[model samples]
Target: TFRVVGHFNTGKALVKATCGRTFNSESDAQTFLDACASAGHVVSSIETKPSTKKPAAPFTTSTLQQEASRKLSFSVSRTMGVAQRLYEAGRITYMRTDSTNLSDVALKAAEKEISKTFGAAYAFTRTYASKSKGAQEAHEAIRPTDLSASSIDASREEQRLYDLIYKRTLASQMADAKLDKTVAKISVSGRDEEFVARGEVITFEGFLKLYLEGTDDEDGQDETTKDMLPAMTEGQPMTRQTVVATQRFSKHPPRYTEASLVKRLEELGIGRPSTYASTIDVMQKRGYVVKEDRDGTPRDYRVLTLSGTAVQAETATENAGQERGKLFPTDIGLVVNDFLLEHFQNILDYNFTADVEGEFDVIARGQLDWRAMLKRFYAPFKETVDTTMEHAERASGERILGVHPESGAQILCRIGRYGPMAQIGGPDDEEKQYASLLPGQSIETLTLEEALDLFKLPRTLGEMEGKKVTAAIGRFGPYVRYDGKFVSLKADEGDDPYTVTLERAVELIKAKIEADAKALIKVFEEDETVRVLNGRYGPYIKAGKLNAKIPKEEKPDDLTWERVQELIEEAKNRPKRGRRKKS
Candidate 1:
């Protein structure tokens, strides 16, 4: 069995010993700690405090591309090129944003465009506003910098992005996207499954013309969104297409990529507009991550990172009796959570976290004293920590490893209720204790021999080969009653058979409709006026069954244009009095 990599917990002192390197400067460590303190302040402390300032700047090209790619799967290059064309053609304002606020001139242009394009009813009294407190209001919002200019013919890529951004921007400047949402609750095998559909009716396509997925900025709204369902009234029953029953195992914390990392940074309030890209670059350069090429028909590469904070937390716990500044969790994060909830349930109260946040908010607003707030929080938290340490049983630091022998590959085992057990691995011998992996596993782990063998088989016979019989499983013929009224026409049989080519089909249908018979066939044809010919009844007009007939002596040519015109005029000038009574 091949061993890939194994993990063990160790402290900073043990880490230095493992590397045979001495700690030279304690002050350097202090400097690093000071930087982390500053980061913490910016993240948890400052961001928690409310700001009354203007919003941040509008989205820059990179940020816009990143967001679009993250949310919509738009490529960065495609996003930039399309945004460029929109700006040049006067469809959208400048694509670049380092400033969050719109200028007076830009605001006026947007307002005028809104009024002119949508009308005053749809236009706003005030330009749309955003609530971002630190927004740079110098640059204009992502509006069409020039409203008077007309749109131009765009390049292929430009056309797509231009249409999307333009629609988003316009929607942003307009009203909320109105949608009627419906959810159908279905019962399957005694389980409640909900199928949802959303009928999104653009009541007003607002700034959505410029951007779609984001906090509703450029407008003063605090509404968040949920994936909506199609419109339907309550009590309306729906037929389910299929019941898909699937089993899912629990999952570990997901590894973050560049896009996900940026999302996390936003959520953490650790980084902002200009710093996101650089922070990703920094993490990559710091040896915390490694980028690998993805294997496929066309190969692409992406970065993968190991959490340094997680590693540090693992190491800190190894130094049993030493003061580790602040307590951290790593391999034991979930275990600690389970233990706290199972035993010390009251200490980690659900409402405790929210209350602590409330106290911080009060402090920031000068409604509560900061020192008192910290004192109240620390007393309980410190007591809980001490109790947990005194009462909780110790965890044995175990080095975990598992391997499958058949393919000589590493197995990703988990620390289960039993010891480290194989969760995934290569195929193994059934008799041995090795993990028995199934066939047709992932393509990435497939050997070259296996791949070549797949292509070696004849997937289909050559054109010259004899007829190959195959099972006819599903319904194969046109819908017909089984009462034997319809004739069975196979490849070898024929009855009322006609070639179904496009030309022949059209001609047949046309002939059927134009026949001197039923009117049903004429329903789809262009001519709405119907024609009729009679013998004994002569030529009778059937308009609403109020019939008239031409005399037998009168020829069709006798109805001249002059007489028709005179009759039309006479009808128009007729008196509105009651019809003359038949005498």
Candidate 2:
């Protein structure tokens, strides 16, 4: 026997249950259901309530990146870069700010702009308090320098981001939106289960007229919240519709995105507004985490009955063009995280990091001495580091798979200097071979079957002109080798080099050879013997150690000795490249 609890939103429902007694067999559940068949049940009560949705607070550094990612599909780095450029160009105010408090001047300008553009009814004179724990009150939230400047000469990306800032700033000062919330309760005829239905209708748009803040949900918002319920009374008669019983399994927590990670860091008070972008940048550069394009396929599917037959129909797939950017830990990342967790638990602990951040904040506020805080933290940290260096295990991430079937060699997965790699045989063995794992494949989850498949590489693809041609996976991807030349296989269109036929390999090799042979254009008739060649950067003339680009009007083949001499002379007088001095 079991007890069931349910919560509903409009037509949507979520059911939860707790087992009262163990059922060894299906007959036990059936016997309990038979006993409860004669019991009576009915709708007890239905209620309606009014709710209000306040306008979102002005965008902080973290919130801006989060919204830009959702609405503009911009990366954290890209958003910050564009914002920096905008700030320098006087198109916007300082972008690296945490406080949501608007300046009196900016607030007055916003009121005028909102009243003039959206009418006086849309404008509301209100102050938004910053909810961030340790936000810097001196700096205001991101906003435009001039509210009346509706257009700017900028790139498309800059214009899109500027518009988002403008709308959000204007909307932040708007009135709270009014909503009519309705909730219904229906009890089963024979069971004690009471199902609830909830819905909300927007009575007043208010700030929604200007903007609606984006959510972290992959599907954006709940559709049930927008749906209206049928006219229900206190004890209305209810009829049973088709029942759906779905079996679902719990899912692990989702991986973090750049936006979500920034949000988390801000929430934990781990970093300040100016450091969020740099922290994410350093992580990516060090290859601790990678921004991977993940498939955002939802789990919900609809059921349609046709001619007494039930058919499952899937909803339309979303995030088609807007591929979700998810951060995945690489093998090196996993190793580094594990090592830190084992040896430096205090440093890696969330609460410890947050507390340290609080100490920094105290120092900034002049409530605590900076040197004292450092002394308190550094002593134990140094001791721990010194002790851990002698006892920590090597973070090689090496594990043994079963032996190979044909060679009887032991297969091992390990993190090499470059990346995670699989090997057949050991260093002591005479015939040891190594292969890199494919992108997205990890050493931890790679199976023996997959490892064996890597050994089939470096496959011979017949001979060409008395030279052996072979296909192999290299550090830079798949390639075909012939004679002394290596030809890269184009796998962009789903072509696999492992299964590429000899004919295709020969074609690719020939194409590469032809391309390499076509680089030389002509030799100039000069004492310096300047040679003109077609290079990747375009046609250019090389004279000894110096090189000069050929003009578009003058082709490499059409260049005369006089033209070559003039180009070389011109290149000699050109300014040399140098590092820019800081202002």
Candidate 3:
């Protein structure tokens, strides 16, 4: 059944309003409703104030990387690569920078562009101070060398990034966006309960005409607050519609994305603008972190509403904790981190890295001796490293989960040679079971049930072609093994070896069969192992343990038995790389 709380009207279409706050309990909301009904609600206070939003500073290196990631879905390295290309092509200024200050010539160009394009009224010359102290990196922020070229002759990513840099450069010199913000407070006469409504009206477009916050446009505006409140005086009586209190829990601090990690590192002064992408890349390469996209889990929440002294409570579900290209630490990363924290406590501190950076800067300016700095850092660092090497136990990052219900064996998760995995027995136990952890599961968060699920793989899905089809996790990842061939599960499709249905497995098997059929060129009567096949780099001969490449001069289809044997022998006798021929 449904009930009408109240009707919402589209007012002047100039602002957006948030009506009520989430209540701690349903009774608290009910009590507020009783007060509203008994006291009667009225506009107790109202204020319309002039507000002006200043245009943001021009693109700095870190800002460029962040905005590109958020707006264009480009990774930090990809953004840097594209920016480097733009820089080499002489399309933009230096890609690497930590400053927000613009050059006089660039500032003049920006002002001229703003004046000619958006009128002289919109032009406002200004300089921005950088957040970083002693920031003289390349002197100017990242911007287009040619302001006239709104779009660059480059790839789609390059053009999009160019447009962002261009608009930001122009907007930095443009006028502030003017707005009139109206806020109203509704009071209950019987009690001290009140509700607040906020509305905003754009008095002047200013820089917003070209670029809004976080987004740039040559023409129309991005979506903004357009539901302006109706005219109401302080003494004017207001009708009670409804009071809603949603049950919301405090969220954990969000995990860092590649861009956010760079930002955080910058805040700590850990790395230079040029090093952020490389550092993050190294972390991923060394198995310290992984970037992944994940679907959020559904969480049930409650809502309590009061309309004219009637209170009702209901539960609802919402997808929560969805992650896209977010970086998460691996088990090994955590273990290594713990080891470093335990043994090299002072060195692992982020401030230590930042202070090292500061020392580098001081040395660069000739204010400090480089040799002294090295001696100071290396002596203590070397001593700690040697001490740890000799005394510290190897960090396997092992965590003991509960015992197995059936075998009474201990269940433990740790970093395995292949990756993170779960074990069914202790180190002293002779007989034990081991299963590779699924790509999505982690040692830190894996539960007993999830760990048990890992062992459930290699399960027979069903029979196909009179043979059993089973799904399992291999060193390469999850796969569906059918008959003698293996069809790997698709990561992008979110296929799980554990949950893959027989029908899906059969479909994958057929697809693999069809693909193999297309790849086969010709079979040889000379030998069963020797056959012609089409591969990624064109046609090649598969002979037993070795592959012989077909020369461009000889057509694969026209190759004779004698030529095939000669090619195979040539491939076999060819000296392997790094081996010297005997004199």
Minimum summed lDDT over a 10-residue window in model 2 is located at 302-311
Ordering by TM-score: 3, 2, 1
Question: Per-model C-alpha lDDT, please?
Answer: 0.39, 0.75, 0.81
The better candidate by lDDT, 1 or 2, is: 2
For candidate 3, write residues 1-583 as lDDT tens digits: 1211222222332222234444466566556655555566567789999988898889888888888887888899999999999999998889789989888999988888888888999999998888864355655798889887777678888899899889988998899889888887766676654667777789888899897555322233443554567877787766555655666666687889877887788888888888989999999999898899889999997766666667777898998888778898888889889988899889878888888888888888899999988997899889888988999888888889899999889999988888889999998999988898876678888889888888887889989879999999987899999878999899799788868999999999999999988998888787866889999999999887799989998889998888999999999999888957799
- Return the top candidate by TM-score: 3
Candidate 2 error regions (>4 Å) = 1-44, 219-225, 239-241, 295-323, 366-394, 427-431, 522-533, 539-583
Report the C-alpha lDDT of model 2 over 140-164, residue by residue, as the tens digit: 8888899888668899999999999
Model 3 stretches with alpha carbons more than 4 Å out: 1-22, 215-227, 460-470, 482-484, 489-514, 522-531, 541-549, 558-583
Which candidate's lDDT is highest? 3
Per-residue lDDT over 218-323 for candidate 1, one digit per residue giving the tens place of the 0 to 100 score: 2233322433233333443333221111111233444444455554444443433445565555544543333332322322221111223221211111211221
